[model samples]
Target chain A: MGVPDPADAELVRRARNGEKVAFEEIVRRHGPAMYRFGLRMLRDEHAVRDCVQEAFASAWEALDQYRGDAAVKTWLFSILANKVRRYLRSQARSVPTEIDEGVIHSPAQHEPERRAIAGTMMAALEEALDELPLAQRACWILYEVEGLSYRRIAQIQGMSVDAVRGAIYRARQGLERRLEAWR
Target chain B: MEMSPERDLGPPSDLLARAAGELRQLTDDGWVRAEQGVLDRVARALRSARPVRGRHEGGDFFLSSTVLCAQVGTRVDLIPGVRASSVRIVTDDVDHLDAVTLTVSVAYGQAIADVGSRARGEAAAAATAALGVQVRTDQVTVDVLVEDVFVDEARDDGGADDAGED
Candidate 1:
């Protein structure tokens, strides 16, 4: 068997002491998750990529100040939430956004019938998500899609846990209404 | 008391629940396609943020303690039965070298003293090579603290003594 990699706490300890390779390990572990998060939050391909890159850059610069009070992934999402909000503020964009369909690839593509169904459902879900307010969508994605705990999502969004639950509840209701055809 | 919407969140709909799972899969696929490009951009951005403070070697030259610690960590990790968890370089006033502390975890069944001594020697050599400022290996004060002893699960020999596994 291959040697087991060190835990995140160990990596963070090394990174705090100025190990670029350790920090790189962190990026490798969390980058994909952050990318998925960015895509869910910002439908545009370029914007999502930029958000993930900027979040990592900020994290690397602030490694010295990280106190490890929260999970590394949670801290990363907090930084990413700040970057996304800043980007949104600069653009002042409207809701009901359109995603770049070309970037989406479904794992069910091998089965043609399954692919068609998944494609339709995914399109509907994306539209439903796009219609949600940014905060509601973010709360829903972080809690539902990313499987983050409500407390962790609250930490990332700087809101009360009750507020996160409320947002998720409303988002779920809206999604249920919009995607009723698929059920 | 009024029932808050949050508290009244009924059983999640099967369609939305399935949609959430599918969204996770969809986003994961997209991320795989763009992962390399994103990481490359991140690496490029961090290049300019290297540590700035350093000990003046001489004649406008300096050696960063951060750099030294990284090197020490790399070298110490190469030793069998030991893994470096943290490496720190201490400098005195006037920016002179003070001591190097390496916290490491030793594999179960390996002699703790032996691993620590080997790590100390490697750290001193690494610091000397990294600075290259006429400092001898013997002049470097190296401390290796055994913060943990871990089971080398691959080599599970049961006759071990004093594993001190943490």
Candidate 2:
């Protein structure tokens, strides 16, 4: 019911009942967004894609846990978010935080404000987003962009509403600081 | 237990918001494909999960054997508690049913004679015909195990089988 299509419920039912077609629909519908969302958060193309795939695989196995209360999209994002967190934890050991100034703050930052379009101007925003602590970035994405309520966002991020609010505030502050000139 | 219902509006950048929207669409579409793929796989899995009968074929022959069981067994009874969900024919040894004695499981309350039992025989005959096997009815020894018993007072009253009734 939470999803736009009753077909989603039917798909969920079939998936729960072991229908492969239904499962495929779920994957196809969510896979690209999953990768992109994970990519935006994780910033490593390979790691983000892996996390997205891992999340779908995990959701496939535990599909019965989908109560239809939250949209399957929401449930999947939660899974993806968890995978990203785990990835971050693993990477914390091998590679210290190193910002890719070339891919991000390259000579491209020289463009004037009037030409400051989302297509180009958001590179620093993206870098700043990528640079954020994973939790804060997740909060910002779910809250300000995805338009999910703070409560649901909190559930996905494994943080309290107050903490989520703080994360969003901090994420916003971080973004504004990086793009202060554009404002 | 550590779960909470906390929420957030995400990062306050409008461009990022738009990007996330576009990203969500992309993810949703991709997942639709993934779901379809998984659904196909799951359907294949479930279909394969059906109970396979015998080393080769002749699953339907079991029903024919059941019929033969009903004919030869001392007890005139019916199967109970279920219906004929599905029936299929498979390969069998040419003389598989020749003097083969087996117990037949059928339900009483859940199956009607003309529907379940009769249909079962019909299916078995079809299967036998399909296999090019002419079931003579004499070559098979089927013992119907009457697991359920009930009084059909109409038959017990003998109003129909009574030869005296013109």
lDDT of 2 by residue, A1-51 (tens): 123467676787677556666777777776665665665675555465556
Candidate 1, position A180, lDDT: 85
After superposition, the stretches of candidate 2 with alpha carbons farther than 4 Å from their true spots are A1-5, A95-119, B1-166
* Native contacts present in each candidate (fraction): 0.41, 0.14
- Name the lDDT value of residue A168 in candidate 2: 77
lDDT of 2 by residue, B1-166 (tens): 2222244233346645554554454334334434444444434332212221222253432233322322322122232332222222222465254432222334434354433444344434543443345544444332223233233433353211111100
DockQ agreement of candidate 1 with the native complex: 0.18
Segments in model 1 whose C-alpha atoms lie over 4 Å from true places: A1-6, A93-119, B1-11, B47-166
Q: Give one digit per residue, the lDDT tens place, for model 1 in A36-88.
A: 88877776667777788888888876664454546789889899988877777
Per-residue lDDT tens digits for candidate 1, residues B1-166, read: 3235655355467887888887777766666666777667656654222232333445534566656666778788789888787677777666666778888988988999999989998888887676655344467568889988877745874322221111
Compared with the true structure, the alpha-carbon lDDT of candidate 1 equals 0.71
Worst lDDT run of 10 residues, candidate 2 chain A, spans: A101-110
How does chain A of candidate 1 score by TM-score against the true chain A? 0.82
